[model samples]
Structure formats: structure tokens, C-alpha cells
Target: MLHVYIEPVPKGQWGPIDGYRIETQDGTRLSGELLRSERLAVSQAKLHGYVPLLATVRIPDKAVAEHWTPADKAPVTV
Candidate 1:
């Protein structure tokens, strides 16, 4: 499991994202956008899903960052 961060794009803002950051328990950094639905779910689950747009940074032993690559340009929805 990789550390995932879910940032929002704001209600009316336009850009890569709005605010927020997710990090692994060990301090690995990941960034991306979180959907409203997912945001609601996170309050219940305590975990956020990186969807529509996501960036995963590899961690050594705690979690593995999969499916994301530098060459990929489309948004990644979890």
C-alpha cells in the first residue's frame, strides 16, 4: 500500500488542484485530486482515493506505488 494524498480542485477554482496533501505513515509523499464522493467516503474510511488525477511516489518498504508512471498524461482515477 502506497501513501496517497487527496487534494481538492476547489468548488470554482480552475487549476491542477485546490488544497490538501496526503503522506504515508513513514513520510512518503503523494499528490492528486480527490472527488467529492470520495471525500465523503474518506471521512468514514479514513483513507482517500486518488482519482481523476494522481501522482504516486515510491516508498522503500512501507508501500508500493503502482499503475502511475511519468509518461502517462491522462488523469488517474482510483
Candidate 2:
């Protein structure tokens, strides 16, 4: 069983199924989903508590940029 933090995309205009960003305490981030009427269960033997099965997208370190860049494409003259 895995516990993850989910951050939803803004606006909520993506229909019933929207995208979410999932992250862990160790700084691991991924994409996931949240749906209504979803039932999740886990055996105590596996996690010692309840657990939910969810879908998540994988985001690699390279995919994330530490700093923000200019939106417009312009060559920087040093």
C-alpha cells in the first residue's frame, strides 16, 4: 500500500476525469486520477491498514525544471 499526495489541475474543465499530480514525502512526484464512487480496500497484512488502488502518471526528474523560463522564445545575447 502506498500513500501519495495529489494536486489537481486548475479550472476542473477536463470533464468527470481530470488529471492530478501525485507526490510522496520523499519528493517523488507523479500524475494520478480521482474518481467518484471509487472503493478501495487493503488487507491489514499488507499495510496494516486500509489502502486504495489508484492510477498515477510517472514524472521523471528531467521532466521538471527547477527554475521558470520565459514563455516567449527569444535569444539571450550575452
Summarize candidate 1's per-residue lDDT along 1-78 as a digit string, tens digits: 232433333523555543444444454444344444433423322434333223343222223345333213434343
TM-score of 2: 0.25
Number of the predicted model whose lDDT against the real structure is largest: 1
- lDDT string, candidate 2, 1-78, tens digits: 454433333323444434344444364553334322212111211233322222232322323343212212222211
My TM-score estimates for the predictions, one after another, are 0.22, 0.25
Query: What number of clashing residue pairs does each candidate have, in the order they appear?
Result: 3, 1
Q: What does candidate 2 score in Cα RMSD to the true structure?
A: 15.3
| Residue pairs in collision within model 2 | 31-57
Give per-residue lDDT, candidate 2, residue 27: 42
lDDT, each prediction: 0.37, 0.31
